[model samples]
Target: MKATILLFASARETVGAPSLTVELDENSTVGGLRSALARACPALIPLLPFLRIAIDSEYARNDQQIIPHDAELAVIPPVSGGSSLEIPAPP
Candidate 1:
């Protein structure tokens, strides 16, 4: 199956492309895509470990299978969401 993966943030900067279309196995997983992506874009190998795979805007696990459908795939870079505020416990 062939799918197009969108890139964002650091991932976009790393590849220098907004998106990529690659052929993958029908039962490919997020981890598998990482491998194929590394081959397609050698520069991304280092970032693969840190990048997160999103299917339809939702985070996907490495072992999660890439469903054969019109799902939006995105390579999301680590985002710093700022430190959390302290919350006091109530009795």
Candidate 2:
């Protein structure tokens, strides 16, 4: 099965690409795909826990099975909400 993985923000910089198309097993799990990515790019392992995955625009669990020939593998990192709180600058 062929799938396209869309990377965002840090994930894109970590993998050095905005997107990647790869072949995966028809019954591959999200976790499995993550592991495969780690194997391919060791730099991503540390950020795996911080990353979120969505399939077909819906958030998916790590163990969620990937559907073959589908178009919604997007990697989303935690997004920041605007806040008025300010931190003190180093003196």
Candidate 3:
């Protein structure tokens, strides 16, 4: 299966690309994608723990199945803000 992965903020910089196209096995899980990413981009290995993944624009869990033919996938790192709150502040 094939999917497009989008990187955000530091993840974009670390992976050295804004997005990439990848092929995976059918019914691949989010965790499987992370392993594939680490193989494709060594820089992503250490940071995987801090990253968040999305499937079709929604947050995804490690066990989540990737619908490569039906959805877009993204591997995003935690975004930082100047504010003290750990969660994203309202715009």
Candidate 4:
């Protein structure tokens, strides 16, 4: 089976690509994909645990089965702070 993994943020930087295709067994799960990714990109091993995986736009559990042909897998790294605003003082 072949599936495409969409990389985001740190994952994209680490893999040096926006997306990648991987070959797996017919019974591959999310966990299996993780292992395959680690093998393909050693730099991603440290960040793998923190990544949130989504299949076809839905968050996937580690053991969730992956349907290579129909799944749109994405690897989302942890997000940090963004913009913030302060409350105005009472006059």
Candidate 5:
């Protein structure tokens, strides 16, 4: 089975594409997908660890989560943007 995973943000930038396709076993699970992706695209290995995978528009709760055939898959980029706190320096 092959999965065309949608990419976003840094993941998209790294792959130079909005999506990537990888071959997987018939009973591929979320964890298996990760492994296959890494093997298919080594450049994504660094970001793969932090990126969240959504199956059928829902986030996979755990690595063991199963992925059914023809299911929608996406590599959700890590979130950014939080106001930094500033502390006053004492004289």
Candidate 6:
């Protein structure tokens, strides 16, 4: 089965691409995809644990099965805070 993986943030930087096409088994799970990704992109190995796999816009679990044809897969990296909250002055 062929599937497309969308990479984001650090994941994209690591793989040096916004997306990639991979061949996986019909019954491949999220964990299986991670392993295959690690094999294909060694740079992603260390970051895999911190990344989340989303299938069709929903976050998928490790054991969740992936349907290649109907799935829209994405590798979401850990997110960090941007700015500090400000306190408003009493009028």
TM per candidate comes to: 0.84, 0.79, 0.80, 0.83, 0.81, 0.84
Candidate ranking (TM-score, best to worst): 1, 6, 4, 5, 3, 2
Error of 1 at 18 (Å): 0.5
Task: Give the C-alpha miss distance for residue 72 in model 3, angstroms.
Answer: 1.4
Clashes of each: 0, 0, 0, 0, 0, 0
**Which residue pairs show backbone clashes in model 4?**
none
Residue 3 in candidate 4, Cα distance off native in Å: 1.1
lDDT string for model 1 (1-91, tens) is 8889999777788779999888888889999988889988998877777789999989999999988568899998777576222221332
Q: Rate the local accuracy (lDDT) of all candidates.
A: 0.83, 0.77, 0.77, 0.82, 0.77, 0.83
Query: Which has the higher lDDT value, candidate number 1 or candidate number 5?
Result: 1
lDDT of 5 by residue, 1-91 (tens): 7789998877888888999999988877888888987998898787766778899888885555555687889987656545222212333
Q: Lowest summed-lDDT stretch of 10 residues in model 3?
A: 82-91
Q: Write the per-residue lDDT of candidate 2 for residues 9-91, one digit (tens) a residue.
A: 77888788998666678889998888777776788777777778889888889988987556579887766556322322333
lDDT of 6: 0.83
Better of 2 and 6 by TM-score: 6
Candidate achieving higher TM-score, 3 or 5:
5
Q: Give per-model CA RMSD.
A: 7.9, 5.9, 5.5, 8.5, 7.2, 8.6
For model 6, residues 1-91, the per-residue Cα lDDT tens digits are 8788999888888788999778788899999899889988998877777789999999999999997567799997866566222222333
**Candidate 1 has which clashing residue pairs, if any?**
none
Candidate 5: C-alpha RMSD to true structure equals 7.2
Per residue, candidate 4 scores C-alpha lDDT tens digits across 1-91 of 7778999888998889999888878999899999988988898888887788999998999998897568789997766556222222333
